[model samples]
Target chain A: MEKKDGCVKPSKGVIQTEETKSAAEPVQNGKETQKMLAKVGKPAPDFELSAFFEGGFKNVRLSDHKGKWIVVCFYPGDFTFV
Target chain B: MGVEVVAISTDSRFSHKIWQEEELSKMVDGGVPFPLLSDAGGRVGTVYGVYDEDAGVDIRGRFIIDPDFNIRAMEVLTPEVGRNVSELIRQVKAFQHVVETGEVTPSGWQPGKPTLTPGPDLAGKVWKEWKPEMAFD
Candidate 1:
């Protein structure tokens, strides 16, 4: 079932357990996997981080975008995938 | 596309700089129009709850913030999957339309399409008027 915010719970078959960890392996679906969290309509947690922008090294703070829409996307690592 | 897209990764600034200069620059030269932010310390990822503490990195997490800075949408994918950039853009456009017109878009709703007016019976109203092609059910 999907939550009010459009997130669907993984089917029972998709949930992995510790017992399955060692003896079993995730079936490859020939698709890329992603990890995500945060419910829509909820307050986004604030944070301060360093960024390499065109200008120079700078502190990027979530609160800094107070009046603007921010698309914060997290990738597993940099330069690994394009 | 006036929306700002920021990509965060746990890689260090030096590595980020090298990648941007060596690789990302090619995309910028080829018309990639957004900025990539380096989350060297993983602080941003941690706060966003996408952090993989054991791996010392973040999982795929996408958040759409409104003009007022409230989170309007959030999607977390498993680490092996990547996000759909086009869908993100579409969602931004749909959100912009809703913010401007005060109308709500149904599932898979796109621009220039009919949007439902909000009321006490919003879900049912939306469902009743929803096109079968647009809905999962």
Candidate 2:
């Protein structure tokens, strides 16, 4: 992917169909077997994953927060000294 | 400040619960004030290009996504170094400023600082309007 005019070009034509198919499943069990579609300067790849929030477990989808800025942080593991 | 934050890892929800209660809660009053997501088998991480298949974990990385769902900036680093929260906040503010106004921020630009208008006339004349020392001030 290349950055142009402050936006990254998205990889074309392969993400939509796969995303739609995955969306059909009510819950994703971390078994997503599709190609990576995320590119910097392009729409973030849609995802639905289980999350522990507010003392409870709930499913969180990336698309749910449309129209709001989001910060997605990835860490190696929990309880690590980092 | 109208931003939503989430942290993802290969750990299960159960593990997140323990860590939140035993560790994160001590760092902050009520622990991290955002969702602790479980990516389980690195499914989500793989899509973001941060998953380590061999290590079975996601590396340390962060992405700032705009309200339009477009990724504006991303940072990835090795485990030895911790990410800086101040820099993240600064970048977020810069992005918001650019979105609100069509001006681009200079390096280390903060709120209330002068911004540059993007155009051909402003290209070479940048040195006249903005100085190298301004970035440090």
Candidate 3:
């Protein structure tokens, strides 16, 4: 992928997980992974995860926020510098 | 501006609580004004293609999902650098403009700036309507 300003490409040495490995595989005989992975211009995969919100833990589902734009960010870990 | 922001990491909720209290609160007035999600085992990250199984963590990434749940933009980068919040907000505004006006935003486009109306007439004549210097201004 081409690197743009304020964005760096993931290292080539990074390991791909099993799910991604299967998803990345070239289609053969018209068979492909049934699971839908998040991609630009495609519907985001839905997920329900626990969250720490307002001094309490709560279950947050992506679909629950339908009809509103959502910005989902992921980081390596907590307590680490941004 | 009606966007819901959430952050996810492999850390547990307890860790998020402590981080918010001990670190984030000091930076922001009352800690980040968004939900700090805990993605155990990187399941959510796996679907987003940002999980690092060997490291047991999700690499730093961000996604802008439209109201319809379609991913309009995504940024994936290593942890060495922090993501730019201004750029993220800019793109969100640009997307919102396109959705409302059916006009395409040019590079570095901002609100009240020139937007191109997509059609055959504006195809090759883009330079006549917008100039490269306009992006910087």
Candidate 4:
């Protein structure tokens, strides 16, 4: 099994109670909505979705690739620029 | 020399078929060494952070990932403009070179060319050996 760091791994069955909801507060929130979303020097989020390939559509999951480079490029709507 | 290029666009398979049959097939006839992927549901775009939520479409985004699945570089171009394939190829080659040898590629660098040694004190060494025609100082 793949092992993750302790900070990212949450213990099982650790559910937040109602009291914890009110205690939690926003640490620091920014209001820059719709900003430049794509960023470099970060982990590219993996995904699996229906894609048309090899003359047919297939479900492609990101985890399907255990160790391989995946260049996921997203273009605008087909047949229309902008 | 072995790299996978996956191109995704928010379009139905039918539309993708039309594009391949009408336009891309011609490019393939000429020379297109890659396959085009159709993101019919736009989910892949959403995960890649390229989805235009209001417009319900994805912008132009390119991601370079290493064999270990770590993203090394990414570029998202404006919708009005297109990306430079030559520069993309150059970057892929440069990254491959760096992975093979501990070297840094200057801007506009090409393969089989000299590279900079990454160090604070070696700036002058890089600058002295740098070629202005490369468009990097």
> Which candidate has the highest lDDT of all?
3
- Model 3 lDDT at residue B14: 80
Q: Candidate 3 on B1-137: residue-level lDDT in tens?
A: 99999999988888898999999999999999999988877877877889988999999999999999899999999888999899999999999999998999998798889899999998899999988898784
Error in Å for residue B102 of model 4: 1.3
Backbone clash pairs for candidate 2 read A8-A41
- As a whole number from 0 to 100, the lDDT of residue A3 in candidate 3 is 44
lDDT of 3 by residue, A50-71 (tens): 7789987766888788899999
Worst 10 residues of 2 chain A by lDDT: A5-14
Instruction: Summarize candidate 1's per-residue lDDT along A1-82 as a digit string, tens digits.
Output: 4233212211121122343233333346974232322357755555555566773455566666777778888888877763
Instruction: State residue A65's C-alpha deviation in candidate 2, in Å.
Output: 0.6
Q: Pick the candidate with the highest DockQ.
A: 2
* Each prediction's whole-model lDDT (CA): 0.67, 0.82, 0.83, 0.63
DockQ of the candidate models in sequence? 0.28, 0.45, 0.40, 0.30
When just chain B is superposed on the true chain B, each candidate scores a TM-score of: 0.83, 0.95, 0.96, 0.82
Descending-lDDT candidate ranking: 3, 2, 1, 4
Candidate 4 CAPRI level: acceptable
The C-alpha TM-scores of every prediction are 0.72, 0.84, 0.83, 0.71
Top-scoring candidate (TM-score): 2
Model 1 segments beyond 4 Å from truth? A1-38, B30-33, B120-128
What's the CA error at residue B64 for candidate 2, in Å? Answer: 0.6
